[model samples]
Target: MNITRRALLAGTAALPLVASAQTASGVGRRTMNHVKDHITRLVDQHRDGVAPIVSLGDPVLRQPADPFDGQVDDKLLAEFIELMQRTMRAAPGVGLAAPQIGVPVRIAVLEDPATVSDEVAEARHRYPLEFFAAINPDYRPNGHKRRGFYEGCLSMPGYTGVVNRPYSVHATYTDPTGHPHHKTFTGWQARIVQHETDHLRGTVYVDKLEPRSLSTTENYLDNWNDPIPTRAAQALRFHLD
Candidate 1:
């Protein structure tokens, strides 16, 4: 999530794993410095202690996370759920994976208020998301439709690229309470699910994007009306369906 696969593909595959959840790799340092500052500001304003995001290039982000067995007490899972939810909200991102916080467990949390103008809401099919947690989740595309848009990551703070994804998906998982659950998702909801699930599988959005379309947030905003690059489809020789 933090470091795009292309960065590694470009010759930095040797990035090390984070020693601790709070530690970021050399690549993460620059972006995380800003994240830390943002956290500090949040602390100063609201006193929330948010967990730091694990940077890209960490081995954990590249390795499949461990699935949780119901062996642990409900108390612990409840606490972990709260912590992950708080961390996700604190990071202020729509989703957070266990590996992003250096926990190698197959758990993730997601919520989105779609706090934007009508254009964004219409474009993303955004909806107000209530707090939800997924344990050992999995999903499959409907194969009926596909979507692409500028995707960003908390781990990969400053950069964004357009990623094509299924417009709808069906997924299944267990809740922290050991309850089994299954559901279908579409639009932005589906995208969020895919993004977090990818983290659990050691796959990042960067792995699916056009390498030439990658750009810093600032650059992306400056160069394109939307995050999608103008010549990206032609240059990349791919069409969004």
Candidate 2:
């Protein structure tokens, strides 16, 4: 495939593909610099890697927030929307939130790259595997009614967790344009939505742990589900309580 000069230029859409190519080829100074730029932009706008809107132990993170109350305009929210997309696309992230990037607004985006099944393929022909976003959202899970999956978060960076989540969920939120919307999610998609939503409420994956499931970066990403059999330990830890 031709790497068009346009594609080579640094920006959102092309940067991801180019970075992937560079890594597959070989690591060099220039390629490394491009990777850094892509990762930095995705991590946070702040130089110090802290978000401005929600801080640790903020009450706002706990209380459910109202949908964008029709006051914030589309033009004004455009940057946050763009940041959300850049955040999710440039990294291994399946979803992202404004607070994690230091923007306090109730905004986030998600992408489910999984393939559709044969049963859903016909439906997908009409509605393919696409990206979605939720603004100032609320969700309900039927009492930990889903399978446990490995999860990672941008805020926690490098560290990941194996947490239990509802296999399915339903949520309501506004689009970037202030339009109210609702949808149901299941499987990996359900997990991503719940993970990012927690960010809006000032919580992290660490909070969803069961004590015995918690592990350091090395342990979680490496040993993973094959973790040394230690059933007596707490599965997870909550950063706050």
Off by over 4 Å in 2: 1-67, 115-129, 142-144, 225-241
| Per-residue lDDT of model 1, residues 1-241, tens digit only | 2222333222210122343642444544433444344333433443345566788888979988766544245765666666667776655678889788776668889888767668767877877768799989999997778878767887776787778889999999888776888899998888899999999999988999766667776665555434234455565555544
Report lDDT (CA) for all predictions: 0.69, 0.52
Backbone-clash count (model 2): 14
Specify the highest-lDDT model's number.
1
TM-score of each: 0.76, 0.60
Worst 10-residue lDDT window for candidate 1 reads: 7-16
Count of backbone clashes, every candidate in sequence: 3, 14
Cα displacement (Å) at residue 124, model 2:
19
The Cα error of candidate 1 at residue 168, in Å, is 0.2
Off by over 4 Å in 1: 1-48, 225-239
TM-score of candidate 2 relative to the true fold: 0.60
